[model samples]
Target: MAHQERVVALLRQPNSMIAEGFAFMEAQFVALHEDIYVAQPKGFEDPVHPNHVYKLRKAFYGLKQAPRVWYEQLTQYLLHHGYDRGSVDKRLLVKTTRNHVTIAQIYADDIVFGSTLQKYTDDLVEVMNKEFEMSIVGQMTYFLGLQVKQSSEGYFISQKKYAKNLVKKFELESSKTPRTLISTSTKLSKDDAGPPIDSTVYRSLIGSLLYLTASRPDIMFSFGMCARHQSAPKKSHLIAAKRILKYVRGTIKYGIWYSKESELSVTGYCDADWAGNIDDRKSTSGGCFFVGKELSIMAEQETKLNFSEHS
Candidate 1:
Protein backbone atom coordinates (compact mmCIF):
# COMPACT_ATOMS: atom_id res chain seq x y z
CA MET A 1 0.00 0.00 0.00
CA ALA A 2 2.89 2.39 0.82
CA HIS A 3 4.48 1.54 -2.50
CA GLN A 4 1.24 2.34 -4.32
CA GLU A 5 0.95 5.68 -2.53
CA ARG A 6 4.54 6.57 -3.40
CA VAL A 7 3.94 5.77 -7.05
CA VAL A 8 0.87 8.00 -7.15
CA ALA A 9 2.65 10.83 -5.38
CA LEU A 10 5.57 10.70 -7.82
CA LEU A 11 3.45 10.24 -10.94
CA ARG A 12 1.01 13.03 -10.14
CA GLN A 13 2.14 16.36 -11.59
CA PRO A 14 0.50 19.54 -12.85
CA ASN A 15 -1.47 18.81 -16.04
CA SER A 16 -1.00 15.06 -15.66
CA MET A 17 -3.77 12.41 -15.59
CA ILE A 18 -4.32 9.02 -14.00
CA ALA A 19 -6.89 6.31 -14.80
CA GLU A 20 -7.97 2.96 -13.32
CA GLY A 21 -9.72 -0.14 -14.69
CA PHE A 22 -10.09 -3.88 -14.19
CA ALA A 23 -9.98 -6.73 -16.65
CA PHE A 24 -13.31 -8.38 -17.45
CA MET A 25 -13.36 -12.14 -16.79
CA GLU A 26 -9.93 -11.65 -15.21
CA ALA A 27 -8.97 -15.25 -14.54
CA GLN A 28 -10.98 -16.91 -17.30
CA PHE A 29 -8.86 -15.26 -19.99
CA VAL A 30 -5.77 -17.27 -19.09
CA ALA A 31 -5.04 -20.83 -20.28
CA LEU A 32 -3.87 -23.32 -17.69
CA HIS A 33 -0.28 -24.55 -18.16
CA GLU A 34 -0.85 -27.78 -16.20
CA ASP A 35 -3.76 -30.15 -16.68
CA ILE A 36 -6.47 -29.78 -14.02
CA TYR A 37 -9.55 -32.04 -13.72
CA VAL A 38 -12.86 -31.30 -12.05
CA ALA A 39 -16.10 -33.19 -11.59
CA GLN A 40 -18.63 -32.21 -14.24
CA PRO A 41 -21.57 -30.17 -13.04
CA LYS A 42 -24.89 -31.96 -12.58
CA GLY A 43 -26.67 -30.34 -15.55
CA PHE A 44 -23.66 -30.19 -17.89
CA GLU A 45 -22.39 -33.77 -17.54
CA ASP A 46 -22.34 -35.83 -20.75
CA PRO A 47 -24.18 -39.14 -20.31
CA VAL A 48 -21.40 -41.26 -21.86
CA HIS A 49 -18.63 -39.37 -20.02
CA PRO A 50 -20.53 -39.21 -16.69
CA ASN A 51 -17.95 -41.48 -15.07
CA HIS A 52 -15.03 -39.25 -16.19
CA VAL A 53 -13.94 -35.88 -14.79
CA TYR A 54 -13.58 -32.89 -17.06
CA LYS A 55 -9.99 -31.75 -17.78
CA LEU A 56 -9.71 -27.95 -17.53
CA ARG A 57 -8.11 -26.11 -20.42
CA LYS A 58 -8.77 -22.65 -18.94
CA ALA A 59 -8.35 -21.25 -15.46
CA PHE A 60 -11.32 -21.33 -13.08
CA TYR A 61 -12.11 -18.83 -10.33
CA GLY A 62 -11.54 -21.21 -7.40
CA LEU A 63 -8.53 -22.97 -8.89
CA LYS A 64 -5.30 -22.40 -6.94
CA GLN A 65 -3.38 -21.70 -10.13
CA ALA A 66 -5.91 -19.19 -11.47
CA PRO A 67 -4.12 -16.12 -10.13
CA ARG A 68 -0.71 -17.19 -11.35
CA VAL A 69 -1.86 -17.96 -14.90
CA TRP A 70 -3.83 -14.73 -15.08
CA TYR A 71 -0.81 -12.74 -13.90
CA GLU A 72 1.42 -14.42 -16.46
CA GLN A 73 -1.06 -13.70 -19.22
CA LEU A 74 -1.28 -10.03 -18.25
CA THR A 75 2.48 -9.78 -18.02
CA GLN A 76 2.91 -11.12 -21.54
CA TYR A 77 0.32 -8.68 -22.87
CA LEU A 78 1.94 -5.68 -21.15
CA LEU A 79 5.43 -6.72 -22.25
CA HIS A 80 4.24 -7.04 -25.83
CA HIS A 81 2.80 -3.52 -25.56
CA GLY A 82 6.29 -2.17 -24.73
CA TYR A 83 6.04 -2.05 -20.92
CA ASP A 84 8.92 -3.13 -18.72
CA ARG A 85 8.30 -4.85 -15.37
CA GLY A 86 9.73 -2.89 -12.46
CA SER A 87 13.04 -4.33 -11.22
CA VAL A 88 12.25 -3.86 -7.56
CA ASP A 89 8.45 -4.33 -7.62
CA LYS A 90 7.24 -6.92 -10.08
CA ARG A 91 3.70 -5.50 -10.05
CA LEU A 92 4.85 -2.18 -11.50
CA LEU A 93 5.12 -1.82 -15.31
CA VAL A 94 6.68 1.16 -17.05
CA LYS A 95 6.71 2.31 -20.67
CA THR A 96 8.93 5.11 -21.93
CA THR A 97 8.64 6.79 -25.31
CA ARG A 98 11.19 9.57 -25.66
CA ASN A 99 10.57 12.03 -22.79
CA HIS A 100 7.09 10.74 -22.02
CA VAL A 101 6.87 7.88 -19.50
CA THR A 102 3.68 6.05 -18.62
CA ILE A 103 3.41 3.92 -15.46
CA ALA A 104 0.97 1.21 -14.49
CA GLN A 105 0.66 -0.76 -11.25
CA ILE A 106 -1.25 -4.05 -11.09
CA TYR A 107 -3.10 -5.46 -8.09
CA ALA A 108 -4.67 -8.76 -9.11
CA ASP A 109 -6.76 -7.79 -12.17
CA ASP A 110 -7.20 -4.12 -11.35
CA ILE A 111 -4.79 -1.73 -13.13
CA VAL A 112 -4.10 1.91 -12.24
CA PHE A 113 -2.05 3.86 -14.77
CA GLY A 114 -0.99 7.42 -15.53
CA SER A 115 1.32 9.56 -17.64
CA THR A 116 2.58 13.13 -17.98
CA LEU A 117 0.77 13.42 -21.31
CA GLN A 118 -2.87 12.36 -21.72
CA LYS A 119 -2.12 10.82 -25.11
CA TYR A 120 0.10 8.15 -23.65
CA THR A 121 -2.61 7.07 -21.21
CA ASP A 122 -5.21 7.02 -23.99
CA ASP A 123 -2.96 4.99 -26.29
CA LEU A 124 -2.32 2.45 -23.58
CA VAL A 125 -6.01 2.11 -22.91
CA GLU A 126 -6.69 1.54 -26.60
CA VAL A 127 -4.06 -1.19 -26.83
CA MET A 128 -5.28 -2.81 -23.62
CA ASN A 129 -8.87 -2.87 -24.93
CA LYS A 130 -7.66 -4.48 -28.14
CA GLU A 131 -5.85 -7.22 -26.25
CA PHE A 132 -8.22 -7.85 -23.35
CA GLU A 133 -11.79 -7.08 -22.31
CA MET A 134 -11.12 -3.81 -20.52
CA SER A 135 -13.49 -1.72 -18.46
CA ILE A 136 -11.86 1.69 -18.65
CA VAL A 137 -12.88 3.69 -15.61
CA GLY A 138 -11.70 7.07 -16.74
CA GLN A 139 -9.93 9.28 -14.14
CA MET A 140 -9.30 7.52 -10.86
CA THR A 141 -11.68 8.66 -8.14
CA TYR A 142 -11.57 5.59 -5.92
CA PHE A 143 -9.65 2.35 -5.68
CA LEU A 144 -9.13 -0.15 -2.84
CA GLY A 145 -10.93 1.92 -0.15
CA LEU A 146 -8.86 5.04 -0.93
CA GLN A 147 -10.72 8.02 -2.43
CA VAL A 148 -8.59 10.12 -4.76
CA LYS A 149 -9.47 13.60 -5.96
CA GLN A 150 -7.17 14.71 -8.77
CA SER A 151 -6.94 18.34 -9.74
CA SER A 152 -4.54 20.65 -11.54
CA GLU A 153 -2.76 21.42 -8.28
CA GLY A 154 -2.40 17.84 -7.02
CA TYR A 155 -4.27 14.85 -5.57
CA PHE A 156 -6.30 14.63 -2.37
CA ILE A 157 -6.48 11.05 -1.02
CA SER A 158 -8.82 9.95 1.73
CA GLN A 159 -11.13 7.17 2.93
CA LYS A 160 -14.14 9.22 3.96
CA LYS A 161 -16.71 6.58 3.02
CA TYR A 162 -14.77 3.75 4.65
CA ALA A 163 -14.41 5.75 7.85
CA LYS A 164 -18.12 6.42 8.03
CA ASN A 165 -18.91 2.75 7.46
CA LEU A 166 -16.43 1.77 10.20
CA VAL A 167 -18.11 4.06 12.71
CA LYS A 168 -21.50 2.67 11.81
CA LYS A 169 -20.31 -0.93 11.72
CA PHE A 170 -19.53 -0.84 15.45
CA GLU A 171 -22.74 1.09 16.21
CA LEU A 172 -20.75 4.06 17.45
CA GLU A 173 -22.68 6.74 15.59
CA SER A 174 -24.20 8.04 18.82
CA SER A 175 -20.93 7.98 20.73
CA LYS A 176 -19.31 11.30 21.53
CA THR A 177 -16.33 12.29 19.39
CA PRO A 178 -12.96 12.95 21.02
CA ARG A 179 -10.50 15.73 20.32
CA THR A 180 -7.50 13.52 21.06
CA LEU A 181 -7.07 9.98 19.72
CA ILE A 182 -5.77 8.60 23.00
CA SER A 183 -4.99 10.07 26.40
CA THR A 184 -1.30 10.71 27.02
CA SER A 185 -1.69 9.71 30.68
CA THR A 186 -3.21 6.34 29.81
CA LYS A 187 -0.95 3.36 30.60
CA LEU A 188 -2.23 0.00 29.28
CA SER A 189 -0.65 -3.27 30.44
CA LYS A 190 -1.32 -6.98 30.03
CA ASP A 191 -1.61 -7.46 33.80
CA ASP A 192 -4.49 -5.02 34.17
CA ALA A 193 -7.38 -6.44 36.28
CA GLY A 194 -10.06 -4.80 34.13
CA PRO A 195 -12.69 -7.30 32.91
CA PRO A 196 -11.52 -9.26 29.88
CA ILE A 197 -13.22 -8.40 26.58
CA ASP A 198 -13.80 -10.74 23.65
CA SER A 199 -10.46 -11.19 21.94
CA THR A 200 -12.15 -11.54 18.57
CA VAL A 201 -13.94 -8.21 18.88
CA TYR A 202 -10.75 -6.53 20.05
CA ARG A 203 -8.87 -7.93 17.07
CA SER A 204 -11.61 -6.85 14.67
CA LEU A 205 -11.23 -3.28 15.89
CA ILE A 206 -7.46 -3.45 15.53
CA GLY A 207 -7.64 -4.99 12.06
CA SER A 208 -10.07 -2.34 10.83
CA LEU A 209 -7.93 0.48 12.19
CA LEU A 210 -4.82 -1.07 10.66
CA TYR A 211 -6.40 -0.83 7.22
CA LEU A 212 -7.50 2.71 7.99
CA THR A 213 -3.84 3.57 8.62
CA ALA A 214 -3.21 3.29 4.89
CA SER A 215 -4.54 6.86 4.49
CA ARG A 216 -4.53 8.11 8.09
CA PRO A 217 -1.08 8.71 9.52
CA ASP A 218 -2.35 10.60 12.56
CA ILE A 219 -3.84 7.39 13.94
CA MET A 220 -0.66 5.32 13.49
CA PHE A 221 0.83 5.84 16.95
CA SER A 222 -2.38 5.46 18.91
CA PHE A 223 -3.51 2.57 16.74
CA GLY A 224 -0.24 0.72 17.31
CA MET A 225 -0.50 1.18 21.07
CA CYS A 226 -3.96 -0.38 21.19
CA ALA A 227 -3.04 -3.18 18.76
CA ARG A 228 -0.43 -4.58 21.17
CA HIS A 229 -3.17 -5.67 23.59
CA GLN A 230 -5.08 -7.70 21.00
CA SER A 231 -3.76 -11.02 22.30
CA ALA A 232 -5.73 -10.65 25.54
CA PRO A 233 -7.70 -7.46 25.42
CA LYS A 234 -9.30 -6.16 28.63
CA LYS A 235 -12.01 -3.56 29.20
CA SER A 236 -9.36 -0.87 29.60
CA HIS A 237 -7.67 -1.82 26.34
CA LEU A 238 -10.99 -1.84 24.51
CA ILE A 239 -11.77 1.58 25.95
CA ALA A 240 -8.45 2.88 24.66
CA ALA A 241 -9.23 1.38 21.25
CA LYS A 242 -12.70 2.98 21.17
CA ARG A 243 -11.14 6.33 21.99
CA ILE A 244 -9.38 6.15 18.61
CA LEU A 245 -12.68 5.49 16.88
CA LYS A 246 -14.19 8.47 18.66
CA TYR A 247 -11.35 10.64 17.47
CA VAL A 248 -11.73 9.32 13.93
CA ARG A 249 -15.44 10.11 14.04
CA GLY A 250 -14.62 13.75 14.71
CA THR A 251 -11.96 14.08 11.99
CA ILE A 252 -13.37 11.65 9.48
CA LYS A 253 -12.59 13.88 6.52
CA TYR A 254 -8.94 14.39 7.34
CA GLY A 255 -6.48 13.23 4.68
CA ILE A 256 -3.03 13.86 3.21
CA TRP A 257 -2.57 16.21 0.28
CA TYR A 258 0.18 15.80 -2.31
CA SER A 259 1.16 19.02 -4.07
CA LYS A 260 2.43 19.03 -7.61
CA GLU A 261 4.68 22.01 -6.97
CA SER A 262 6.37 20.45 -3.96
CA GLU A 263 9.99 19.33 -4.42
CA LEU A 264 10.67 15.63 -5.10
CA SER A 265 13.35 15.42 -2.41
CA VAL A 266 12.74 12.68 0.17
CA THR A 267 12.73 13.32 3.93
CA GLY A 268 12.45 10.93 6.87
CA TYR A 269 12.04 11.15 10.65
CA CYS A 270 12.68 8.32 13.11
CA ASP A 271 12.69 8.03 16.91
CA ALA A 272 12.53 5.42 19.66
CA ASP A 273 11.22 5.47 23.21
CA TRP A 274 13.41 3.65 25.71
CA ALA A 275 11.64 0.84 27.59
CA GLY A 276 8.17 2.13 26.78
CA ASN A 277 6.22 -1.13 26.89
CA ILE A 278 5.09 -1.80 30.46
CA ASP A 279 4.59 -5.52 29.87
CA ASP A 280 8.00 -6.49 28.38
CA ARG A 281 9.98 -3.27 29.05
CA LYS A 282 10.76 -3.08 25.34
CA SER A 283 11.25 0.13 23.39
CA THR A 284 9.01 1.31 20.59
CA SER A 285 10.65 2.60 17.42
CA GLY A 286 8.82 4.44 14.64
CA GLY A 287 9.66 6.36 11.47
CA CYS A 288 7.77 8.32 8.84
CA PHE A 289 9.03 9.05 5.34
CA PHE A 290 7.79 11.89 3.21
CA VAL A 291 8.04 12.62 -0.48
CA GLY A 292 7.80 16.35 -0.65
CA LYS A 293 4.81 17.34 1.53
CA GLU A 294 2.99 13.98 1.37
CA LEU A 295 3.67 11.10 3.75
CA SER A 296 4.64 8.08 1.68
CA ILE A 297 5.46 5.63 4.47
CA MET A 298 4.99 5.34 8.22
CA ALA A 299 5.78 2.35 10.48
CA GLU A 300 5.99 1.44 14.17
CA GLN A 301 7.71 -1.57 15.70
CA GLU A 302 8.04 -2.79 19.30
CA THR A 303 11.62 -4.01 19.55
CA LYS A 304 12.85 -6.81 21.85
CA LEU A 305 15.92 -4.80 22.89
CA ASN A 306 15.56 -3.55 26.46
CA PHE A 307 17.60 -0.98 28.38
CA SER A 308 17.89 -3.34 31.36
CA GLU A 309 19.42 -6.06 29.15
CA HIS A 310 22.13 -3.65 27.98
CA SER A 311 22.66 -2.28 31.48
Candidate 2:
Protein backbone atom coordinates (compact mmCIF):
# COMPACT_ATOMS: atom_id res chain seq x y z
CA MET A 1 0.00 0.00 0.00
CA ALA A 2 2.91 2.35 0.77
CA HIS A 3 4.39 1.65 -2.62
CA GLN A 4 1.01 2.30 -4.27
CA GLU A 5 0.68 5.62 -2.43
CA ARG A 6 4.22 6.66 -3.34
CA VAL A 7 3.66 5.86 -7.00
CA VAL A 8 0.44 7.85 -7.05
CA ALA A 9 1.99 10.82 -5.27
CA LEU A 10 4.93 10.89 -7.63
CA LEU A 11 3.24 10.19 -10.98
CA ARG A 12 -0.16 11.82 -10.51
CA GLN A 13 1.09 15.23 -11.67
CA PRO A 14 -0.17 14.37 -15.14
CA ASN A 15 -3.35 12.75 -16.50
CA SER A 16 -4.13 9.48 -14.67
CA MET A 17 -6.58 6.60 -15.12
CA ILE A 18 -7.45 3.48 -13.14
CA ALA A 19 -8.58 0.17 -14.70
CA GLU A 20 -9.56 -3.23 -13.33
CA GLY A 21 -9.65 -6.63 -15.02
CA PHE A 22 -13.25 -7.86 -14.96
CA ALA A 23 -13.71 -11.14 -13.03
CA PHE A 24 -9.94 -11.06 -12.54
CA MET A 25 -9.26 -13.89 -10.13
CA GLU A 26 -12.01 -16.36 -10.91
CA ALA A 27 -12.10 -15.71 -14.66
CA GLN A 28 -11.26 -18.54 -17.03
CA PHE A 29 -9.37 -16.16 -19.34
CA VAL A 30 -5.98 -17.24 -17.99
CA ALA A 31 -4.33 -20.00 -20.06
CA LEU A 32 -2.22 -22.61 -18.31
CA HIS A 33 1.17 -23.55 -19.73
CA GLU A 34 1.33 -26.83 -17.85
CA ASP A 35 -1.26 -29.53 -18.36
CA ILE A 36 -3.31 -30.22 -15.23
CA TYR A 37 -6.40 -32.23 -14.37
CA VAL A 38 -9.06 -32.10 -11.70
CA ALA A 39 -12.04 -34.16 -10.63
CA GLN A 40 -15.28 -33.23 -12.32
CA PRO A 41 -17.79 -31.32 -10.23
CA LYS A 42 -21.27 -32.63 -9.50
CA GLY A 43 -23.60 -32.53 -12.58
CA PHE A 44 -20.65 -31.62 -14.82
CA GLU A 45 -19.30 -35.15 -15.38
CA ASP A 46 -19.61 -36.63 -18.83
CA PRO A 47 -21.72 -39.75 -19.22
CA VAL A 48 -19.05 -41.73 -21.14
CA HIS A 49 -16.06 -40.54 -19.09
CA PRO A 50 -17.79 -40.64 -15.71
CA ASN A 51 -14.68 -41.77 -13.81
CA HIS A 52 -12.14 -39.73 -15.76
CA VAL A 53 -10.84 -36.44 -14.35
CA TYR A 54 -11.31 -33.19 -16.30
CA LYS A 55 -8.23 -31.68 -17.93
CA LEU A 56 -7.80 -27.97 -17.23
CA ARG A 57 -7.03 -25.82 -20.28
CA LYS A 58 -7.52 -22.57 -18.33
CA ALA A 59 -6.96 -21.32 -14.80
CA PHE A 60 -9.84 -21.59 -12.31
CA TYR A 61 -10.58 -20.26 -8.83
CA GLY A 62 -9.85 -23.38 -6.77
CA LEU A 63 -6.53 -24.07 -8.54
CA LYS A 64 -3.50 -23.06 -6.51
CA GLN A 65 -1.56 -22.12 -9.65
CA ALA A 66 -4.23 -19.75 -11.01
CA PRO A 67 -2.77 -16.53 -9.60
CA ARG A 68 0.73 -17.20 -10.89
CA VAL A 69 -0.57 -18.15 -14.32
CA TRP A 70 -2.61 -14.95 -14.58
CA TYR A 71 0.33 -12.80 -13.50
CA GLU A 72 2.62 -14.51 -16.02
CA GLN A 73 0.08 -13.92 -18.76
CA LEU A 74 -0.18 -10.21 -17.96
CA THR A 75 3.61 -9.83 -17.67
CA GLN A 76 4.19 -11.46 -21.03
CA TYR A 77 1.56 -9.28 -22.70
CA LEU A 78 2.99 -6.05 -21.27
CA LEU A 79 6.57 -6.98 -22.13
CA HIS A 80 5.60 -7.87 -25.68
CA HIS A 81 4.01 -4.44 -26.16
CA GLY A 82 7.14 -2.39 -25.29
CA TYR A 83 6.39 -1.94 -21.56
CA ASP A 84 9.52 -2.50 -19.47
CA ARG A 85 9.19 -4.07 -16.02
CA GLY A 86 10.62 -2.05 -13.14
CA SER A 87 13.95 -3.35 -11.81
CA VAL A 88 12.86 -2.81 -8.21
CA ASP A 89 9.14 -3.64 -8.53
CA LYS A 90 8.24 -6.17 -11.21
CA ARG A 91 4.61 -5.10 -11.08
CA LEU A 92 5.48 -1.57 -12.21
CA LEU A 93 5.62 -1.23 -16.02
CA VAL A 94 6.81 1.83 -17.94
CA LYS A 95 6.68 2.72 -21.62
CA THR A 96 8.60 5.64 -23.03
CA THR A 97 7.64 7.20 -26.36
CA ARG A 98 9.36 10.35 -27.58
CA ASN A 99 9.33 12.69 -24.54
CA HIS A 100 6.12 11.26 -23.07
CA VAL A 101 6.23 8.39 -20.57
CA THR A 102 3.28 6.28 -19.45
CA ILE A 103 3.46 4.50 -16.08
CA ALA A 104 1.31 1.50 -15.18
CA GLN A 105 1.21 -0.15 -11.77
CA ILE A 106 -0.27 -3.63 -11.52
CA TYR A 107 -1.92 -4.73 -8.28
CA ALA A 108 -3.02 -8.23 -9.17
CA ASP A 109 -5.64 -7.56 -11.90
CA ASP A 110 -6.09 -3.85 -11.19
CA ILE A 111 -3.98 -1.23 -12.99
CA VAL A 112 -3.42 2.39 -11.94
CA PHE A 113 -1.65 4.39 -14.62
CA GLY A 114 -0.87 7.89 -15.86
CA SER A 115 1.04 9.79 -18.56
CA THR A 116 2.11 13.33 -19.39
CA LEU A 117 -0.27 13.44 -22.36
CA GLN A 118 -3.96 12.48 -22.60
CA LYS A 119 -3.38 10.56 -25.82
CA TYR A 120 -1.00 8.18 -24.10
CA THR A 121 -3.63 7.23 -21.52
CA ASP A 122 -6.27 6.83 -24.23
CA ASP A 123 -3.98 4.64 -26.35
CA LEU A 124 -3.22 2.48 -23.33
CA VAL A 125 -6.90 1.81 -22.71
CA GLU A 126 -7.48 1.10 -26.40
CA VAL A 127 -4.75 -1.54 -26.58
CA MET A 128 -5.74 -3.12 -23.25
CA ASN A 129 -9.35 -3.42 -24.39
CA LYS A 130 -8.31 -5.22 -27.59
CA GLU A 131 -6.30 -7.78 -25.56
CA PHE A 132 -8.25 -8.35 -22.33
CA GLU A 133 -11.51 -7.53 -20.56
CA MET A 134 -11.23 -4.26 -18.61
CA SER A 135 -13.32 -1.79 -16.64
CA ILE A 136 -12.02 1.75 -16.75
CA VAL A 137 -12.67 3.37 -13.35
CA GLY A 138 -12.44 6.89 -14.92
CA GLN A 139 -10.63 8.82 -12.15
CA MET A 140 -9.14 7.05 -9.16
CA THR A 141 -11.32 7.97 -6.12
CA TYR A 142 -10.63 4.81 -4.13
CA PHE A 143 -8.20 1.93 -4.35
CA LEU A 144 -6.71 -0.64 -1.96
CA GLY A 145 -8.84 0.53 1.00
CA LEU A 146 -7.59 4.14 0.74
CA GLN A 147 -10.04 6.94 -0.07
CA VAL A 148 -8.54 9.26 -2.68
CA LYS A 149 -9.77 12.76 -3.45
CA GLN A 150 -7.96 14.34 -6.39
CA SER A 151 -8.12 17.99 -7.43
CA SER A 152 -6.12 20.66 -9.22
CA GLU A 153 -4.18 21.31 -6.01
CA GLY A 154 -3.30 17.71 -5.06
CA TYR A 155 -4.63 14.46 -3.60
CA PHE A 156 -6.16 13.72 -0.19
CA ILE A 157 -5.95 10.14 1.06
CA SER A 158 -7.77 8.62 4.02
CA GLN A 159 -9.65 5.58 5.33
CA LYS A 160 -12.69 7.22 6.93
CA LYS A 161 -15.05 4.32 6.33
CA TYR A 162 -12.57 1.75 7.60
CA ALA A 163 -12.02 3.80 10.75
CA LYS A 164 -15.76 4.14 11.39
CA ASN A 165 -16.23 0.39 10.94
CA LEU A 166 -13.36 -0.28 13.33
CA VAL A 167 -15.00 1.86 16.03
CA LYS A 168 -18.30 0.02 15.58
CA LYS A 169 -16.62 -3.41 15.53
CA PHE A 170 -15.18 -2.81 19.02
CA GLU A 171 -18.46 -1.29 20.24
CA LEU A 172 -16.91 2.10 21.07
CA GLU A 173 -19.10 4.39 18.93
CA SER A 174 -20.85 6.13 21.85
CA SER A 175 -17.79 6.23 24.09
CA LYS A 176 -16.56 9.63 25.17
CA THR A 177 -13.77 11.01 23.03
CA PRO A 178 -10.34 11.30 24.64
CA ARG A 179 -8.14 14.33 24.22
CA THR A 180 -5.01 12.23 23.99
CA LEU A 181 -4.54 8.81 22.48
CA ILE A 182 -2.48 7.73 25.46
CA SER A 183 -1.31 9.66 28.49
CA THR A 184 2.21 11.00 28.15
CA SER A 185 3.05 9.91 31.71
CA THR A 186 1.56 6.46 31.28
CA LYS A 187 3.88 3.50 30.71
CA LEU A 188 2.32 0.16 29.68
CA SER A 189 3.84 -2.99 31.14
CA LYS A 190 2.79 -6.60 31.56
CA ASP A 191 0.40 -6.64 34.49
CA ASP A 192 0.87 -10.22 35.70
CA ALA A 193 -1.33 -9.73 38.75
CA GLY A 194 -4.08 -7.68 37.08
CA PRO A 195 -7.34 -9.23 35.92
CA PRO A 196 -7.07 -10.94 32.53
CA ILE A 197 -8.85 -9.84 29.35
CA ASP A 198 -9.58 -11.66 26.09
CA SER A 199 -6.26 -11.99 24.30
CA THR A 200 -7.96 -12.45 20.93
CA VAL A 201 -9.97 -9.22 21.23
CA TYR A 202 -6.95 -7.27 22.41
CA ARG A 203 -4.78 -8.53 19.55
CA SER A 204 -7.47 -7.78 16.95
CA LEU A 205 -7.80 -4.19 18.15
CA ILE A 206 -4.05 -3.70 18.16
CA GLY A 207 -3.70 -5.14 14.67
CA SER A 208 -6.42 -2.87 13.24
CA LEU A 209 -4.92 0.22 14.87
CA LEU A 210 -1.52 -0.73 13.52
CA TYR A 211 -2.99 -0.79 10.02
CA LEU A 212 -4.62 2.58 10.61
CA THR A 213 -1.18 3.95 11.42
CA ALA A 214 -0.36 3.69 7.73
CA SER A 215 -2.31 6.90 7.15
CA ARG A 216 -2.11 8.19 10.77
CA PRO A 217 1.47 8.27 12.00
CA ASP A 218 0.63 10.00 15.28
CA ILE A 219 -0.65 6.83 16.93
CA MET A 220 2.29 4.64 15.98
CA PHE A 221 4.25 4.85 19.21
CA SER A 222 1.28 4.71 21.56
CA PHE A 223 -0.22 1.70 19.77
CA GLY A 224 3.15 -0.02 19.60
CA MET A 225 3.37 0.10 23.38
CA CYS A 226 -0.08 -1.47 23.78
CA ALA A 227 0.75 -4.22 21.25
CA ARG A 228 3.53 -5.73 23.40
CA HIS A 229 1.14 -7.47 25.81
CA GLN A 230 -1.05 -9.18 23.17
CA SER A 231 -0.03 -12.64 24.26
CA ALA A 232 -1.39 -12.13 27.77
CA PRO A 233 -3.32 -8.89 27.77
CA LYS A 234 -4.83 -7.66 31.06
CA LYS A 235 -7.50 -5.12 31.96
CA SER A 236 -4.96 -2.28 32.03
CA HIS A 237 -3.73 -3.13 28.51
CA LEU A 238 -7.31 -3.35 27.24
CA ILE A 239 -8.04 0.07 28.66
CA ALA A 240 -5.05 1.53 26.88
CA ALA A 241 -6.19 -0.01 23.59
CA LYS A 242 -9.72 1.36 24.11
CA ARG A 243 -8.32 4.82 24.66
CA ILE A 244 -6.83 4.67 21.18
CA LEU A 245 -10.26 3.74 19.77
CA LYS A 246 -11.82 6.75 21.47
CA TYR A 247 -9.14 8.96 20.04
CA VAL A 248 -9.75 7.47 16.60
CA ARG A 249 -13.48 8.15 16.96
CA GLY A 250 -12.89 11.85 17.37
CA THR A 251 -10.41 12.05 14.45
CA ILE A 252 -12.04 9.78 11.89
CA LYS A 253 -11.86 12.26 9.03
CA TYR A 254 -8.17 13.10 9.48
CA GLY A 255 -5.82 12.10 6.63
CA ILE A 256 -2.63 13.04 4.82
CA TRP A 257 -2.53 15.45 1.92
CA TYR A 258 -0.10 15.17 -0.98
CA SER A 259 0.18 18.55 -2.62
CA LYS A 260 1.36 19.33 -6.14
CA GLU A 261 3.21 22.34 -4.75
CA SER A 262 5.67 20.15 -2.82
CA GLU A 263 8.82 18.92 -4.50
CA LEU A 264 9.48 15.25 -5.22
CA SER A 265 12.66 15.22 -3.17
CA VAL A 266 12.71 12.38 -0.61
CA THR A 267 13.10 13.26 3.05
CA GLY A 268 13.28 11.06 6.13
CA TYR A 269 13.11 11.58 9.91
CA CYS A 270 14.05 9.11 12.62
CA ASP A 271 14.00 9.06 16.42
CA ALA A 272 14.50 6.65 19.28
CA ASP A 273 13.87 6.35 23.01
CA TRP A 274 16.40 5.19 25.58
CA ALA A 275 15.25 1.94 27.22
CA GLY A 276 11.60 2.87 26.85
CA ASN A 277 10.17 -0.61 27.36
CA ILE A 278 9.68 -1.21 31.06
CA ASP A 279 9.51 -5.02 30.76
CA ASP A 280 12.67 -5.59 28.68
CA ARG A 281 14.33 -2.18 28.97
CA LYS A 282 14.75 -2.05 25.21
CA SER A 283 14.84 1.12 23.17
CA THR A 284 12.34 1.55 20.34
CA SER A 285 13.50 3.26 17.16
CA GLY A 286 11.24 4.54 14.40
CA GLY A 287 11.57 6.32 11.05
CA CYS A 288 9.23 8.10 8.63
CA PHE A 289 10.10 8.66 4.98
CA PHE A 290 8.23 11.19 2.90
CA VAL A 291 7.90 12.04 -0.75
CA GLY A 292 7.55 15.78 -0.60
CA LYS A 293 4.93 16.50 2.10
CA GLU A 294 3.21 13.12 1.79
CA LEU A 295 4.33 10.30 4.04
CA SER A 296 5.25 7.29 1.89
CA ILE A 297 6.94 4.97 4.35
CA MET A 298 7.15 4.38 8.11
CA ALA A 299 8.63 1.67 10.34
CA GLU A 300 9.15 1.00 14.07
CA GLN A 301 11.00 -1.74 15.91
CA GLU A 302 12.58 -2.49 19.24
CA THR A 303 16.38 -2.56 19.56
CA LYS A 304 18.21 -5.61 20.90
CA LEU A 305 21.44 -5.26 22.92
CA ASN A 306 23.88 -7.61 24.59
CA PHE A 307 25.33 -6.88 28.06
CA SER A 308 28.87 -7.79 29.19
CA GLU A 309 29.22 -10.44 31.90
CA HIS A 310 31.91 -8.33 33.65
CA SER A 311 29.54 -5.38 33.98
Candidate 1 lowest-lDDT run of ten:
1-10
Worst 10 residues of 2 by lDDT: 14-23
For 67-137, candidate 2 gives per-residue lDDT tens digits of 67877887788788898888779989887777666778777657787765678888888777777777776
* TM-score for all models, in order of appearance: 0.92, 0.88
Maximum-TM-score candidate: 1
For all candidates, what are the clash counts?
A: 0, 0
User: Which stretches in model 1 have alpha-carbon errors above 4 Å?
Assistant: 1-10, 306-311
lDDT of 1 by residue, 1-311 (tens): 43444455446657678889877575346788888889988888888878889888798666778778888888888899898888768989888777667888888778899887788888988887776777887899999999999888888899999999999988899999988987778877885677998999989999999999988999998898898888789999888998898899999999888878766677899998777888888888999987777787788998978244553
Models, CA RMSD each? 2.6, 3.0
**Which regions in candidate 2 have their CA more than 4 angstroms from the true location?**
1-28, 307-311
lDDT of 1 at 107: 86
lDDT for 99 in candidate 1 is 62
Which of the numbered candidates is closest to the native, going by highest lDDT? 1
